[model samples]
Target: MRAQEMWKVSDGTGITVAVIDSGVKDVPGLEGRVLPGVSFMEPPVDHPDQKYPPHDDFDGHGTTMTAAIVGDGSAGGPQGLAPGAKVLPIRTSIGTPMAFAVGGEAAKGVRYAADHGAKIVNLSIGDWYSMDKIRSAVEYAQSKGVLVFVAMGNEGEGNNAANPWAMLPGVLGVGAVDENGDPLPSSSHGQDTDLSQMGGKVLVRCKKNSDWCVQDGGTSVATALASASAALVWSAHPDWTANQVARVLIQTAGAPRDGVKRNDYVGYGIARPSQVLLNHAGDPGAPDVDPLAAPAPAKTPTPGAEQTLEPRAESAAAAGLSWQWPTLGAVVAVCLGLGITVMIKRRRRRR
Candidate 1:
């Protein structure tokens, strides 16, 4: 990713990314950076004792993702890809019973972020089932000119089933790769995957505390980095529309080794933000023409209809390493790759 060099040119200033996940805490590194947002999940009826606030993290996964995107490393936490970017923390339940009972929570969160002042929305979660409510929300975000990035899932070595959110049109599906620039076996793949990034053996802030830890790799981490990469590019080119920013990311990504235009494993290749930030590469195509296919028309929600959705497991793999701060100099480089090529489909554009 050459993040250090890219920072010299643009440290993601004037950009706000919405992190829709478990929740984000006001940890040391993220003290003044995390903006207050809403929580879609409430305490379950059966487990009233489990009340998690919007700023509270249930699994620490959200905090880690937040840190990866914007942590300043002030308290020995992991350095963010876009240190100057601000984060809007929107909390949603994933592994809770309330998540299953409350359908369209993710949709609500996305809409909230878009209505607010977020230019980018990062969804580091995935679900097995596809819900119309969520799809409509994603389309709504795209219509609002907000870029949404989602994890493709970590079941690559298993069923590798498609994640509904990642499959949504106009959303950038992200996959994971390791330090060696090889795709991680656990990173899910499909035609929807638009980019890949360094996720394996990366350092992150632990849940419930400010300590640093290492994550073996997950599409969740890759997705957060992809969002931050967009922040860097958008920060440098504030005048560019969402379509133009998306175009540059795809155009500047590393080409696939097989010489094909795109592959299931790594998409266009890897997202190389440095190609645009440091080297002044990539073409910011037409501001109105979407680089990815345009999204389908949004369906109107039924009035007063109470929708319930089943929550799928999160895309992040369990943390394998124990919490401990390692030497900062020994940290592995967070390399980003892959770019999107314009593959416009003949779908009806959203109004």
Candidate 2:
């Protein structure tokens, strides 16, 4: 990514990015960069509008994502792509597998981020059931001139379950790719996928302790990195609207062939913000037009469509971006071992 060159042009200064996921904690690398964040979960009475260490997320996923977006790497710590950006934490989950499985609260968090002055919001969670409330929240954020980046999900099979956020209009659905710029099989595909980015073995600070670091990757990680890339471009062109930033990215992305427009696996192509910032090789197009949506009015889904609550939150593998949904046999084994059935169907959004 010629990160040094990009930094010389812009370090995401004067930009605020909201991380809507598990809670983000106050770590050494993000001393003053973290703003006050709120939790949408109900059980924790004092979690809302907390200063730092907002929620109970022992797994460190949320903190890892935050570090990827805005960590300054203070005192030889892990450095984020957009060090100059500030992070606003929106805790939608409390780190338990059950809490991570819930999907309805994400809509509320998206609206909150837009209202709180976040230029960009990153959603690293995926759910099987597509809800109107979530779609409406996405529309609200877009109308407010906020860019929302959502995870395309991490299911290797082409026949994964449905993801509502990936189907939403006016939001950027992100897929994962390897260091070689090849699409990982785990990265979900769909008409709404806007772009792909490096999500394999990304270096980030561990939430358990800021001093320690880990290599993690998933569609979740890719979404955070894509938001950081937007922070860089938006910081450079502060006057540019969300549509302009997206247009510039789509226009300058690396297509497989010379004239290829888009494909199912990688969408427009790999995100190369350096091409826009350094080479000045993209047109912002129309500020009022959406780069992904059709010119005609979008057809809204009928209320009370076929929807079911999925109960499992899968984890991204350590190597590739793929995640495994426990098979029936595996579930049985787990039940036998634990003496209780989790009864949670993981939402795989590969479709």
Whole-model lDDT per candidate: 0.70, 0.66
- lDDT for each residue of candidate 1 in 191-272, tens digit (9 for 90 to 100): 7778877667876555444566776647888888889989999999999988888889888887565556667777776787
Best by TM-score, which number? 1
Clashes of 1: 8
lDDT of 2 by residue, 155-244 (tens): 535443324466666777787776566666667665556777777765554535344544547677778878888999999999988988
TM-scores, in order shown? 0.81, 0.78
Q: In model 2, how large is the Cα lDDT of residue 72?
A: 70
- Against the true structure, candidate 1 reaches a TM-score of 0.81
Clashes of each: 8, 0
Query: Residue 338 in candidate 1 has what lDDT?
Result: 14
* Best-fitting candidate, scored by lDDT: 1
